[model samples]
Target: MDEWVERALARFPNVPALFGWLGLDRRGHWLIQGERISHARIVETIARNYGVDDHGRWFFQNGPQRGYIALEYTPLIASVQADDTLMAHTGRAIESVSALYLDEDSTAVLDTPDGAALVQGADLAWVLDRLRADDSDKEIDDQALSNALAVPSGTQTDLTLVVGNDRLPVYRCDRADIPATLGFVQAPEPRDGENSN
Candidate 1:
């Protein structure tokens, strides 16, 4: 087990941990001990307590057990900003959890649930700001935007294409959800003029 997973297990005993590519299961569910929990339930819980957006995506920290969960999303090429309220809410959630592992004294430090030093006086705002900036949206064409919008809805559509150095996929998923084991190959280009070429 990763040391972070161990630490998280020790600290948050009630919380179940799981790690896999593709964010939550495609069916949007999680299994804990022998019981099952829906991803919608988790999102509801987080939203009710921490104020995440209904349509927003979440990034669960990767480890043998769950580490810290970051509620954010990659921007679609069309939109250049994440919901600001969602970003703030995520920062607050991190702050609350970090407080559980950190101490009050300026110099005091504790091991984070993920085993990193939960140093006192760290600027969480700065971290949140950086994350928000990293998730800043971009401009994409109409087709790309349409493809991205279709993914979460479970529509089977061609949303990605490789052109030169660009590996463009229209979906906005948690980065961790991308499978490392999978490799993409370019499709053969169509020959001139003939529609069936």
Candidate 2:
């Protein structure tokens, strides 16, 4: 959260929190009443003020009002930069990465510094470039990736990726458990709070 936004909240301590009116789509675009939010400044403000509550619900603390955001896929999106680096859609530079998983739907999820965010498919090549055979640093192909997932034994070989100045290993996780593993609620319900303004 931005310090100014925090100050605004402190200034107007009785503003109401809005819900069901704001949303965050799969591509990281902000939406209002089912329409796309094209205003760059508003989007930037929302992004800058975005945060989560103690209940693990994501929201944009807009100046004095808290607008709970309903996410389409994930609360955040990790985009590939022109320099092959990764950044959150909210404009946060990815300093450290914990895990990465490619689902059957070709959706790549990343546990980055911001949070667990979905990586745009078009930018998956950066992740693929780092995946190598378990025993070697040689690159892996589609079939090889499948084989890594289809081991007959209990243990399976995972992949690896390098982020910033660290070499991190990627793990394969069922997409069904993403919310649990990442500790984020995809479909956050309404909360009970004082209706003030």
User: For this target, which candidate reaches the highest lDDT against the unseen true structure?
Assistant: 2
Clashing pairs for model 2 are none
**How much does candidate 1 score in TM-score?**
0.19
Which runs of model 2 end up more than 4 angstroms from their true locations?
A: 2-4, 148-157, 192-197
1-197, model 1: which lDDT tens digit per residue? 33565576577665543222222222223334324455775544433332111222232333323322221121100111244211222122221112111111212111122211222223333222222111234333455444444454223223332222333332233233321111111111223441320
Worst 10 residues of 1 by lDDT: 71-80
Candidate 2 whole-model C-alpha lDDT, 0 to 1? 0.76
Tell how far residue 164 is off in model 2, in angstroms: 5.1
RMSD versus native structure for model 1: 19.8
TM-score of each: 0.19, 0.86
Query: Residues 73-157, candidate 2, lDDT per residue (tens digit)?
Result: 7788988898877789999887778867655455678886667889887887877787776656688889878865564322325
lDDT accuracy of residue 164 in candidate 1: 28
